[model samples]
Every structure is written in C-alpha cells, then in structure tokens.
Target: MTNTDVTQLDNPLWYALKGAQQAYAIGSSHIRRYRSGILPFAAYDYRSPGNIAELDSFLEKDEVFFLVGALPSLPSHWKLIRELPCAQMTLELPPAPLQTTTAVTALTAADRDTMFELIHRVQPGYYEPDTHQLGNYFGIWQDDKLVAIAGERMRLEGMVEISAVCTDPAYTGRGYAQQLIVHICRTNLEKGNMLFLHVLTSNERAIRLYEHLGFRQRRVISFWKLINAGTILGTKL
Candidate 1:
C-alpha cells in the first residue's frame, strides 16, 4: 500500500503489531516513550488517526516521533525537517552458512549474564534494561564464555526480527556474527517464520556482511527521531 493510504485500518504497523507479539515486546520501549509523556514526532501506523493540528499541539512540547509501516503525508501546516534513508533487510532460510560453525543453541539462564556482558562489550549502548528483560536470548559459546548472540525481538504474523546481534571485540575477525545470524535465521525458519532486520544506511560493512550471508535489501526506511525537549546534546539514546 502507498504511504498516503496509511490512515486505513489495515496499515502494516497495525497488522504487524496485532499479528506479532514479539514486535510489540521489542517495541514496548518506544510505545512507553509516548505513554511516559515523551511526544513522538514521528508517529505512524494510522490505526489511531490524528490530524496535524493534533500533532502540532504535541510537537511544540517534544517531537520524538517514529515512522512505521509507510510514510504519511504531513499536514500543510507542518514543514519539512531532516530525512535520511534507512534500510531493511530480509534473509530466507534455512540460513545456509557461507562458512560453518557449530549448531546454534538456546542460551541457558546461566548464560544470560555473560551474554549481556559480551553484547555490551561490543555495543555498550545496546540493551536498555527494558530490552534485556524482553525475550529468550540465544548465544554461541566458546568454552565457557559467550562469543556471540542473536535472538528474537519483533514478531508479526509469520515473521520474526533477529536482533541484539553482537560479537566480542577480541573475536571480531572470526565471523561469529555471520555464524550467529545464520543459526538464528535457520532456527526461526524451522519454526516457519521469515527473518527481517533494520540497519543504518551508514553501516556499509554490516550491510555487506548481511548481503554476503544471503540477505537482500527489502526497502529503504526513514528513521526520524524527534528531539526530546529536555535531552542534552550528545546524550545517549
């Protein structure tokens, strides 16, 4: 469907949210932002329609918005702001590896702390306390230490998002991310769902790695974050 038709009840975001509890689970942080009085500058989904005047009222206070499903037409009163093209990638299964590694295994409860530390070491900004508590996490262990991890985030109908992918810094060149991605996607495929993920346009290396591992670019998306009024410059997200 075109972006203009997003106001319809069948908008992708609505169906996606309704169909995928995992998506809702992963995105709960975002939804909570609006619920907690952080005005979303980029609200989409059209499941609950509101006019620009309605948005403008909130816009002046804080403009932390999200654009989901398809882009919507702005009201005449609103002016253009910054726009950047992001990308979504999808990989079909059984995620055949370009290289091989041991079978992916479900992370045990004991593995959680080490898994968190490994991910945080590579990507400290990841794993808000909320995301950490969200779902079952999976990992690849070398000896007793967790080397890499990938797991469920969002779910919609027959699809699941593979997220929280990270590798230990010292282990970067070993293709752990690739192995974990294949293992995760294959695991999801066995359960009869497709895999999809989002990455920044500037992350060329990651995009290339995903492509090499059989993922293809599905579409370009715009990630518009509205600046929260009280947020200090250079503050972490």
Candidate 2:
C-alpha cells in the first residue's frame, strides 16, 4: 500500500481522461470528458480560454455536467449550479482478508434492471442506466433479489474507483455493504490497481466505515455541478 503522488490523487478526472480510460474520453488537447451516459466527469489542465472553449464544445446547450477537482475559470455561458465538498479517499489494496461471502456474484446485463432499481432507490443521481457499461460490478443476492452492490468507475493508469456502493433499506445493519466493498477491493488489488472513491463530506457514517477498512482521506475536492447557460431558454453557446 503505497501513496500516490498528490497531483495524481488531486486531479483524478484529468488523469483518467488522459490515461487508461482515454478511449472513452471526448475532448480536445486541453480538455476531455467521458461520453454522455457513461460518466458526467470532465476536466482540464488549466483555466485557459482555449481549454474552457474545448470543454464547452463537448456539451449540448443547457446540458448539465459535473467537474471534479480544482474549479476552473468559467466562461459566462457556463453556469455553476452547485458545488459539493467531497472527500477523495484512497486504500492500498489486499485489504485484511475479509470473511468471504459466497453469495456475492458478478453482475451482468441480465441483472441490469435490478441493479438500477437498487441504486436508484438507495443512491441515485450519479449513476445512469448505462453506467454499468463503464466497468465491472458485483452484488450480493438474497432470495434472488439484489440487496447490496459495489463496483468500479473512473479508471486511471494504476487506480480504479470503487463506486455505486449501496444496500437495500431492509438489509442495512447486516454488513452487506462492507462485504461487497471488500470483494471489489480484493478483486481490483489482484489486478494491480489501487482503489479510490469519493464520498460527500457530510457522509460521516460512510467515512467511518471506509476508515475502518483502512482507507485514508487523501484530499478534499469540489464536485461542481454546472449547467450549460446556452441551453437556458433555448439559447445557443
């Protein structure tokens, strides 16, 4: 479990756009973003006019997108809707051996609807119907029902994000989330990628659980939700 360079940990979206998941990115030399329906993250090297222009070009008029890391200088046509303070946490893998849960299964397209239902019901907004296309997901089942899930998102050269972790309300106190997270962590660690994730700064309970699992907070980043001003009243950028 080694520490990542501060630059790499601080600007994860930029690195992901420029590294392992570059194939999924859409932007010019200065800015890049994942295609719509995959992930809403976009990033740039600096707050230059050219970089800002390039990022604007990737959005449809009025479409909303999210920017993580340093907030860049924005053109008037881009409006900042909200900014969330988020904690970027990282864990060096091969975590202390978790009690293996045999019922945890690798999820596939056939389980897509159930996955969406569980995620939307518990933790919605960030996940889309097709987000499963971005990476592998795993879940725990109870009587054939998807009760808990944890999966990958945001890939960079040597790191993979563990995201979309959730559990059904009926199953909260049973340690299902912890089991699924350990499963995903062990899997990615075996593949040689360190694990990282973002949680709202206000989510203390989740933070405690992550810390108990050996994850440490690397930095705090702003999750900026922006709306394309050009789309307002059908205006054009």
Candidate 3:
C-alpha cells in the first residue's frame, strides 16, 4: 500500500471554510452581483468596501442565510452569531491494532437520500444552500443504516474540504467518527489534495478528537452573516 504523507497538507483550516457559500437569488440586485463576483476561494478579499453591504443585503432578502468564512469583529448591535471551529487533520493512519471493526466503504448514489437525512438528524439545521454542486460526500453504513460519514464540500484546484461529518448520536462513544476521518484524509492524500474543515472553538470535545487523530490547531477566524445595513465602519477581527 502507498503510504500517506500528512506533512504536505495545507496548514490553515480556514482555507476550506472560505468556499462554503452558494449562490442565492433572494438578495438585492447589487448584493447578488457582489456575492456572485466574490471569489469563493479567496477568503481575504472580503475586506473590500461594500462587502458588508452585500452580505447584509443578502441576509435581509431572506429571513435566514448562510455565510461561511472568517468574520470580522463588529459592534454589539449585531447578534453573536454561531461560531464554527476550524481544524486541519492530517492523513496519518494509526496502528491497525486499534481499529477492530467492520469495514467501511464509499457512499453510492443509492445512499444520497438516506445519507443527507442522517446528516441533518445528527447536525440539525445544517444544509447546503447548493446541493447540486456538493462535492464528494461519503459515508459508512451498517446493515443498511448509515452510521458515520465525512466527505468533501467546497473544492478548489489544489484543495478539497472535509465537511458534513456526523455520526449517530446513539453511537457517539464509538470510534466511528475517527474511522470516517481516516478514510477521508487517506482518500484526499491519495488524490494529491489536502484536507481542511471548520468547527466551533467552544467545542472542546471535537477539538480533542481532532488533535488525537493527528489534526493540528489552526488560527481562529470570526464567522459572520450580516443583514440590512450591517457594515463595519472601520475594523478587522
């Protein structure tokens, strides 16, 4: 078997988080234009003037919207949005002695419906605004029920993101999540792509798991979703 190289992976976990957005038509014409023109792969370019206006307009157009990327620190007038912790896990296979379970496999077209349902069940309110463009989502099933899953979402030329990871809450204590992560990183490394993901900084449990599984801590980024006239006058997070 070809050995995986974890050292060559991308350093910052936020890189994958940059592309979580998908096009939506509910925003103002200008907002839609700006969001469409925004580069999904470049996370830094969002600091430009009117970027906040664009996002705020986008949010006001709809009751709720999804914004993924580093959020800038703003004033107290804005609500404290949910925080997603970002992490980068390397592809280093642990000793085989530790894994003594049934084999895991890639997901198939037949698994899409059930897989998505299972994901929502585990991580409620998590939905891809653009499912048509969803990348390589994978899963492991047991006796026809999807148990654990981890796979790609936003992808650029040299990078692929690992996201939508969810295991049945009832099966939490098991190593199912670790197994799925191992499979994900191995596949990405083999394909010459690096793996990255975002999680809430407050989620100590997940942070511990990633660190134990060979993932390193990366820089923190503020994630935001502004609506109406929610522009930052002058600041950076």
| Per-model TM-score on C-alpha atoms | 0.65, 0.90, 0.66
Runs off by more than 4 Å, candidate 2: 1-6, 47-50, 92-94, 100-102, 231-237
Model 1 residue 232 CA deviation (Å) reads 19
Q: By lDDT, is 2 or 3 better?
A: 2
Model 3 whole-model lDDT (C-alpha atoms): 0.52
In candidate 1, stretches whose alpha carbon ends up further than 4 angstroms from where it belongs are: 1-16, 22-43, 47-84, 92-94, 97-103, 108-113, 124-126, 130-135, 230-237
Provide the lowest-lDDT 10-residue window in model 1: 1-10
What is the C-alpha lDDT profile of model 1 across 159-234, one tens digit per residue? 6667788877766788778877877777666776667777778889999988877788877766554334432232
Per-residue lDDT of model 2, residues 127-224, tens digit only = 87778877899998887788899899888777889999999999888888888888888877777678899999999999999998878898888899
Better of 2 and 3 by TM-score: 2
Give residue 111's lDDT in candidate 2 (0 to 100).
85
lDDT for 153 (candidate 3): 62
Q: Local distance difference test, per candidate?
A: 0.56, 0.82, 0.52
What TM-score does prediction 2 earn? 0.90
Candidate 2: Cα lDDT at 18: 82
lDDT of 3 by residue, 1-237 (tens): 234333323322222333233242233322331133122221223435244343342333223333444454433434644555444443333413346575777776666677767877887555433332456666667767878887776554455667777898767777878777777777777677656666777778987877776666645544444332343333322
